[model samples]
Target chain A: MWARTEEILPYALLLPSLVFLALLILIPMVQALLLAIQADSGEFTTAYLQRMAVDVNFNDAWRNTLLLIVLIVPLQIVLALAMALLVNSRFKGHQWFLYVYAIPLAISDLAAGILWLAVFTERGYLNTAAQGLGIVDQAKVYLSFENFGGLVAAIVIAESWRATAIVMVILVAGLQLIPRDFFEAADLFGANRLRRTLYVVLPLLRPSLQSALIIRTIFAFQTFAVVLALAGRNMPVIAAEAYSWYANNRDAHLAASYALLLLGLTIVFTFVYLRVLGLREAEVKR
Target chain B: MAGIRMQGIVKTFGKTTAIKEISLEVKDGEFLVLLGPSGCGKTTLLRCIAGLETVDAGRIFIGDRDVTDLPPRHRNIAMVFQSYAVFPHMTVRSNIGFGLRMKRVPKPQLERRVQEGAALLALEPFLDRYPAQLSGGQRQRVAVARALVMDAPVLLMDEPLSNLDALLRLQARADLKRLHREVKRTTVYVTHDQVEAMSMGDRIAVMREGVIEQCEPPMQLYTNPASQFVGGFIGSPPMNFLRGRTKAGAFEGEGFSLPMDGSRVEDGRELLLGIRAEQIRFGERGVPARVQVVEPLGATALVTVLVGKVPVKVDAPVNTTVRPDQNVSLAFEPADIRWMDATTGAALAH
Candidate 1:
């Protein structure tokens, strides 16, 4: 009597997409778990689990991935904040600037990698610009660092350019959603630019920034294309390790183990992120 | 408290004119309300004074200093927005202390002033709570406390109480009046509600289409609205108007006639006739009307009477029962009539 059968129609209509999502994401995830448990011996062994930590190459790949997250997370947040703030302001051709910032997001990672490679070439635009600006008479082969810094820089540039749009997009949305009256109230209080940004903008932006962080961190962990293009055959990213196990070693069991490691990393970080967000929500609730 | 003066304030947004050469003065320590329907440019005018919105052509003087071009932060004024606009992240103490902190008042002084503002707002228990953790009224009070912390001479509020529930709104209104008395800051409030404007303001400026139609004390606006629009807008149950011609021949009309007042001008010409619903009386000496509807609202009853071809609503004391579709008659002394220019809708000055 509370609600008629007609009211349930809209909910009933949602079952297909729900089922599709279950098949696409949930089923595969469940299959990975089953495959994790079932070996030829039909006994659950700790062999695959031990491989994730004990295998030197997998360990190094994960270590590098974590390193990438540590370096890129803060950098991406800062850059995105700057971009969102700049776009939030009034200027000539502001919309055009926003559209320009957003364009990298639409390009495929393969395309972006190829495009960035042109700048890295000896006779590329960087060399030409250096000659034109007279900073350097000729282009130097500068990108080949012995360590992973150059690779990190390349990934940063490519990933920053690609993923920054989404952060800027979210922060810009948050910026717009803040009532103009709040700023005016701050203004009335004689809050200077930095004070206002730190106290008001940052605090109001926590939930939004937290959400962006989780998404971007997961994205950073899944950083395959840019890492692959920049890091090349020698560097050991998790995805690169999986590819090596499958195509090179032709070991499906090993490849599945590497894939499962990637999944585990994602789940752990996601759990931590969700737990932090829940705490924040609880504090707000209190 | 400082008086605010504006000379020839004009604000145009591209081709659309928002405020067209508005000029007014707020007396020191006075509560002046800009009362108008939405988009009448009342908010824009308030913003121009608060230094939030710029005026295309104007000179604003706060206590005789030209503040028209100064940035809002430089202007010694505070504002409370309709949304409460409290910073969601800060505890109530920090939110209240934000202004003092901006000026880099020594930390002790900052703490003391924050405490003072909190005490004034009765926000002691909620000092550690964030804006998001508070009720709507609490948030609004925090916003007010934040405004108070500045200790500015003028407080500009744009529909500040509009977001509160009805009972809370009433309480907030009383608190605002009390706060103004204690703080003694010249306040300029903007609202469309006549009740709010009437009750809270020392003087009310009734605006229409970006122009001040009339500015007067509350009783004057009620007893003597400068125009028919002001009359209609500033009253509940509204002033009733009828289109008719005033002629020497018994004030002739299609379904109604009246014994014409001898002193009436524009005779034999079409003009609008307005009467307050409260002024109409029910009796046998008047014109017979069909009782169309009766709406009882506790203490008062509003009766819709069909007189000839025109329907008039009259407010009467409750317990006077009359069924719809019954016969009724209404009469009133002719002196209560208000006349307006039919074309321009401006009241004809008596």
Candidate 2:
């Protein structure tokens, strides 16, 4: 009896979910901003901003996060690409392999970091196995704080194992979407395997690559749990700095300042990613 | 360009055979089309010749070499797929030039070949554009251009025009015919459309269930189809089949009797009598019938008539006095009769 559009009354239905998001997501974000700028001094000065500029600890945190992004994202992309290509082939038990590779996607970063700890600790699996095999005469002194490269390596491996599956899944979908007709046509045209991959597969897969890279960059920029779990307080990341500024020193003002800096960095990185991908070129209409 | 010849080629997928012990030879510079209905393995046979699919048994020769196990690249056979497999990332220039690039042809030679292929397909204006930017017809031309630049001995197509709209299909067909005329390359084309098979092929192979029923010139395929399947599959408003019994020298059906050719008859045996819709005239001594439907095609009318219980169609001039439910005497001349074994469905000689 009533018009369908008029009968449903959509605003009432959408009101509850919007209210929940506003409380849970938006409010906390606003609180973090307020706390970052709160200036622990009685008078609001530029002290928190000065801490970001002159503090060696804050600079170390900045350097470490960038170093991880530089080292981790490209490695994840390459590993994921290789996995996707190997899994894409007509191999038996591909389904089981896919599940095995994808299992880390659901595992938390904290869990993965702890799992790697079992390998890297001084009396851990690596040294124990090396001693058992007679490769080492004594227990190897591993997990030393002085080893910066080891710390970076631990964090890189943790991030790669946990995050590479996303890129693989994206590439796998891209691979499937390529019509088999193209490969047959390429073969008829005398294209070898390498030629086909370059001339046929890579070109068609550009969009998938673009999206996968963007997502991985976003995830890498925010990497926290794995660094903390593996390297502990000795390793300084952006998020760990923010937590220490707020909780340990009881300086919410400096924490929010650090949070704002990380936010700015994230936005800048996203814009750069979007530009690098040339996202609009591949989508030109037929 | 070399002539393609296949001798006793056989291929099977799992337990089912897609192409049986078949043999065909395409002459140098001939446009040959393979025609059949869906699941008839015309495409499968084309792939076998292209070296994209390997035959389970038998040899394939391109001019003088046995190339049964050769990879498609080594065979140098180019194919236009029903879906044009244009590379999505590359510009039209690179896509057409890809075959040359793979051969490690000289830079100048590659550019010259790409230029020539682009000009042939009228793809010069869009050379900088990727396949995603081209129209369907343009993509098809690029696909053909991709094949052409190879300069391979054989150009094989697997229902390349099936994806186009009816109007584009007609244009593409005419273009294909013209292209073949100019190049005079030995080509193997496959389609289910009989008109395409008829208009394009110098020799047509009519197939059914993985076996070629008949291989001959298009006119022979239309006029003297070697099997009941070929007869039924070829013509547009296809051949009309009627069940009849031979007694003495006469063939008796439901509504009327036709005098049998003694050479065609097995005495006192039941058989199928086939007549093309165009073969039987309207105003002749055929069979008495009532007009059930008259479909007015441009210059001719397909008149569907019911004689006793059997439905029959006759092609007559557009201005025939046939109306639904009207009675008329339709005639069948002895010359129009093709006798077939009703049980086996094989054509019997008259």
Candidate 3:
């Protein structure tokens, strides 16, 4: 009796969270799949998914979402690695710099979008500064409706600035796990700084880089508020399209289809990241 | 092979001075050991020579080049850290060949040098294994191989065997000495273990409070330490010190007296008598004391004797039947005694 209770005790304690997860996530995921694949009459059909595939905004949303991910993820990783290395150097007042760099993490995605919008919007800070410096005779419309590149650039900058801190934090944790002696050994062996970082530091940081890539890419797939705030209808992303289908058109089935597509993309990218940065047990242990 | 020369090297960490105007010469192909206690700046000095730590005020010369301003890479030196520092991501072969790879050595030569280093350290079978797959001793061998394959003129080791088990350390010590003899690289090793210094160092520099107290051959350091600190640091059980005053051509302390040799001494001047445990014997007709403790080793027993409240240790044969509370007389040879000035702790010249 005692052995049975001991074996069942952990699961008994976890029952509430398991139930909560089923209700909040698993059940909704099943519902979404059903809604995506079935009609209101409770018969299996491909009508809603086909409608999502042929929607007017579907192609633009797919292209914009992929472009954003491709542009933002790599840019954030490089910036985060540089920031992590700078913070890890432990120079004087580095704590202040770390705190400042992490300030973006405390901001909401929409707030970050609005923050950058203030700089790029017409008569905003950039134009004001350019005009004050006599670099431009008139205020430039950097985020105008016809300027698709400007809108995409604004969204990329905002998203990279806001989300790079998360990658930086993970990388900093990884950098700390490496012994200082490895770097000293590299220096004594006559490796230049760049080569040392490329050969020694990067290989050791694979696990962290893998995690950062997966997390940022998944978050990038779900990006909505930032783009909605910065580009409005000028750019369409997968999440924005899902929201438009559900809230504006009152079509939950099409929204569910878009959400399923986003999920599929996230899984594929995560799998690719895991396979590319796979580590042996020996490398992981130390 | 090249000698290392440092002229008036000084390093300070904020308000605390770590190395204070230290200058030393390491001869070509010399295996010099910097032996000191923790925080003695021995490791710091070794790093300064390696160009890992820049001296605040000094000029460093590797062979004949003034390398004071050069980074470690440009200095053409190799270092084996105490942690072994084998790259976890790379195999032992890659680690051994990493320096050559950095220098872009030809593939054939790189492979040959890596093989030679692996063979020297008996790491041939473990070449394809990552550092995490190997034992601590094997990893240490990989670190040494990595340094040796560099074929750099100067090699710096910061207590490389310190992380190994005691039994492995003994084995590694002998292997390192033999390797050093074979390679003939100018190596500067930092360690706090006196046994390692005595067995491996061609010359040992005893450091204290950021300065070298004495730099000499192992036996010379044992026999003739420049100061009381060096004498106390270099020996097991250390040198026994008895405080006394000189009067009537004899030095008399709490419960002991020894005749002063040819050295001129003022009447009633304060001094300390330094003698090793082995130099003092329990025999007939000398200073009498009560045996407080008897610690037995396989070959010998250390008997602690108290003479008028001052405890002095004497080495006795292991089979001796000495028990606690028994009284014994300790005999000291005049030639074995070192007289030190009590105030400055400097060895008095005879």
lDDT of 2 by residue, A124-239 (tens): 88889999999998876556689888888888988999999989999999889888887787787888877777777776777788888878877887788888888888888888
lDDT of 1: 0.82
Docking class of 3: medium
DockQ of each: 0.50, 0.61, 0.66
Residue B193, candidate 3: Cα error in Å is 0.8
Off by over 4 Å in 3: A1-30, A38-46, A122-146
Instruction: List where candidate 2 sits over 4 angstroms from the true fold.
Output: A1-17, A37-47, A281-283
Query: Which runs of model 1 end up more than 4 angstroms from their true locations?
Result: A1-24, A27-39, A48-59, A90-92, A128-134, A137-139, A143-148, A275-279, A282-286, B13-15, B240-308, B312-337
lDDT of 2 by residue, B1-350 (tens): 78988999999999999998889999988898999999999999999998889999989999898899899999978888888888776788988988888889999999998999999889999999988888889999999998888888889998989988899999999998999998888999999999999999999999888888899999988877787788889988787888888888887888678776666566778888888888777665567788999999999999999878888889989998878998888766677777787887888876
lDDT of 1 by residue, A1-286 (tens): 5476678878889989999999998898776665655576777766765665576687778888888888888888999998888888758888888999999999988678667767765676778889899999768663554656666777778778788888889888888888876777777788777777877777677767878888898888777777666657645878777777778987655666777877888888878867765435524675
- C-alpha lDDT score of every prediction, in listed order: 0.82, 0.85, 0.91
TM-scores of all predicted structures: 0.86, 0.94, 0.93
Q: Is the docking of candidate 2 incorrect, acceptable, medium or high quality?
A: medium
Better of 1 and 3 by TM-score: 3
